[model samples]
Target: MSTIDTSKPHSARMYDYFLGGKDNYPVDVAAAEQVTSLFPAVSQMARTNRAFMHRASRLLAERGVRQFLDIGTGIPTEPNLHQIVQATAPDARVVYADNDPIVLRHAEALLHSAPEGKTAYVQADVREPGRILAVARETLDFTQPIALSLVALLHLVGDEDEPVRIVRELVESLAPGSYLTLSHATGDFDPETWERVVEVYRKGGTAAQVRSREEFSGFFTGLELVDPGVVLAARWHPDLGARQGGEEIPLYVGVGHKS
Candidate 1:
């Protein structure tokens, strides 16, 4: 089992706390509550992000893409990426990656793949794109179309981390028709609230770099964006689905084809 340090607040566990799940520690709940005070929509944002992920996965399955590489995968939630894809295409294969030890410890939930499909977890960081790709290749074919999802993950990556470079490496490794699905927190909606939330994360020992629409869109350079390009999470293909708990929050979601 992966060791979980309950002293610090982890993004995944904090996220789980925000969603009213029991897997989070007191520290995570504290941090999540503090952030919630600043931006009450944070929990809604979490649900929205999950909904977008479901829609994206369904679109990929409908498009005949059977392999998925989800980086920065958080604690396994119900109807996870594998569940959504496998519900439509039973033979789908998925590789979940996250640096969080807590996620690795609870990864058993993610391992329950459909009998005809494959679900595996890799204990790795998003910055280590090559390593993730290498291990994921065992389950996913590099020559075929695979959907790469980084939903609500990039904001945690600070400026010094060179997120753009990491994305470049991952994008270059994928074949044409492979898609990149992303949803990130932005300061555009409410700058003051975003700033307060960023401070909360900084105090928690994690970096949060909330980008604008242009900066978020910049991550998709060299790729072809799908229709209704890079819109708000609530607006992104809203007709496709809805959240189970509550209304969707303000987030930007987009899907881009490698070629």
Candidate 2:
């Protein structure tokens, strides 16, 4: 296992800590507390994101997508993507990518796959789409439809990084009929709360780019958005699975088909 640096708070660890998980350090807890102070709904937002991922993954698996590429996969939490996908399609193959070494150390927990399914983890930053795609290709056949999920991830990639171009590159590499499911944080809900939370993350060594609703939708350009396009994460296909209600947490979620 890699040695975890408790000195600096990592996003994944902070997220895990917010969700009341034990996979984080004191620094992470401190960061979470700071963010929560700014936006009291922080924990609820994290749980909502997790619930969205579960429903989206299940919906994709039911739609016959047996392969998944999940980027910015945070600390291993119960009922991770693989569990959701494999439960629906036993043969599902999933590759989880995260920049945090702590997640890589806990990758073993994520590696536990159903006998008929497979799970692998790669330690890579989201900006390196080439490396991510190359490693994902080993488990996911590019020729087949793959559900590329970037839930609660893009906001972490700021403007200087050209998030649109990064997403386009990854989407272009997939075959037709592939899908992109994502949920991103937005400032459209409450600018005051958003800015404060952004400052907290920025101080933690990562810049948070809380995008506008239109900016979030822009990521789906050149693709057909699934029905009820770009609604709140909780509102996307609620009937697909579990629904955890929280009125204050704001997130935009949508799924698109690569035509």
Candidate 3:
């Protein structure tokens, strides 16, 4: 059994709390509530970000990409990465990687793949791209084009880690025709409220950093941007059902394909 340290707030559990799931602890709730109080849109951003993942996965599946590598996968929310992709391409193969032990505890739900498809989970961090790629090969074939998903993740990686290098390293490992899709918390549009909201995570013992628009877009360098490039989460393929709201979502999402 995986040990969960409930005394401190974890990013996965805090996200589950925001999504109105029962998998969160009190500490996570308190931390999430603190952030919500600072920026009411925090919860809404969570939902919007989730919706973007679904849309992005489906888009990749539609492109005949059957393999996926989802890093920083949070607690099993309804319509998880596998469920979404399997619905589109029942033969799709997926590998979920996360550093959280609690997420590993609940990974059984993620493993429920279609008989025609497959799923695997790796207890690894995104910073160790090589480790994740090696372990994920148990389910996904690295020779084929894969949709590498970093949804709602990178911000947790502090500047000292040189986040751009981390991302580029991962991108370099994938085969061409592979897709990279991601969503990031940014302070570009509304710096005041967004910065305050980030402080809540820092106060809760989580080191988080929100990126600027230019910085966020840099993650997709050297890749072909999908149509309607680098837009707000709600604007990414809205025909696939985006959140309904007039306010700007704090997260920016984009999908790009390697040539």
Candidate 4:
């Protein structure tokens, strides 16, 4: 396991702080505070994003997606991807990947699988799509449909990291009928406030880039989008009982099928 760096703020840890999780350090708290000071609704946005992940995971599982590969999995919050999907389909298999060593330290919480299901965690960065897919194959069958979830993750990946290419590589590795579920923070609603938030993250030593709606939609260039495509995070499948009145949340979310 890599050593956990406490000097500089990490996106995963900072996110944990936003979600009211206690797994973060002082550095993360400071950075999260800076973000909140810039955008008061940031914490609400984080919670809403998490709710979207739960809804998407359960919907895919209900639609017969038995395997899930969730990259950029943050600190283990209760009712994680495996928990949500496996609840609907106990035989569901889930593989989680994240680069944060602190997340790795708390990975035990993520490994509690349902008796009929299985779960595994990989300490890998999203940039290393090959490694993630390779390890995920050990648990998830690449020949069957799998839901590739990148929830509230890509914004931390700057343009230089080639996030779209990363998504393409991961999606290409899955079989036909595979699904891609993504939720990313966007600056389309309030670009100026988001710009300041990005600078806060950069000064804290983390690469942050909020995208426009068009740029966010580019990730699903070839895949077929599901109903109510590319809307605010809360608008995607709200029948799943996601939080209400999230119109101000500056995040774009959608799920697509690889037909």
Worst 10 residues of 3 by lDDT: 241-250
Q: lDDT tens digits, residues 125-243, model 3?
A: 88898899889877887788999999999988878778889889888888999999999998887788777877878877667899987898999999999998998888888898745
The better-scoring model by lDDT among 2 and 3 is 2
Q: List the residue pairs that clash in candidate 3.
A: none
- How does residue 193 of candidate 4 score in lDDT? 91
lDDT of each: 0.89, 0.89, 0.88, 0.91
Q: Candidate 1 residues 1-259, lDDT tens each?
A: 5687888898999998877788888898999999988888788788888988999889889999999999999988898999999999999999999999978888999999999999999999998998999899888998999899999999999988999999989988999989999999989978888988988898887888899999999999999999889988877777778543333365888999987
Ordered list by lDDT, greatest first: 4, 2, 1, 3
RMSD of 1: 1.5
All candidates' TM-scores?
0.96, 0.97, 0.96, 0.98
Cα lDDT of model 3 overall? 0.88
Better of 2 and 4 by TM-score: 4
**Model 2 lDDT tens row, 162-242:** 999999999999999999999998899789888888888888878678998899999999999988899998788888767
Q: Model 1 — which ten-residue stretch has the worst lDDT?
A: 242-251
Worst 10-residue lDDT window, candidate 2 = 240-249
- Residue 258 of model 1 has an lDDT of 81
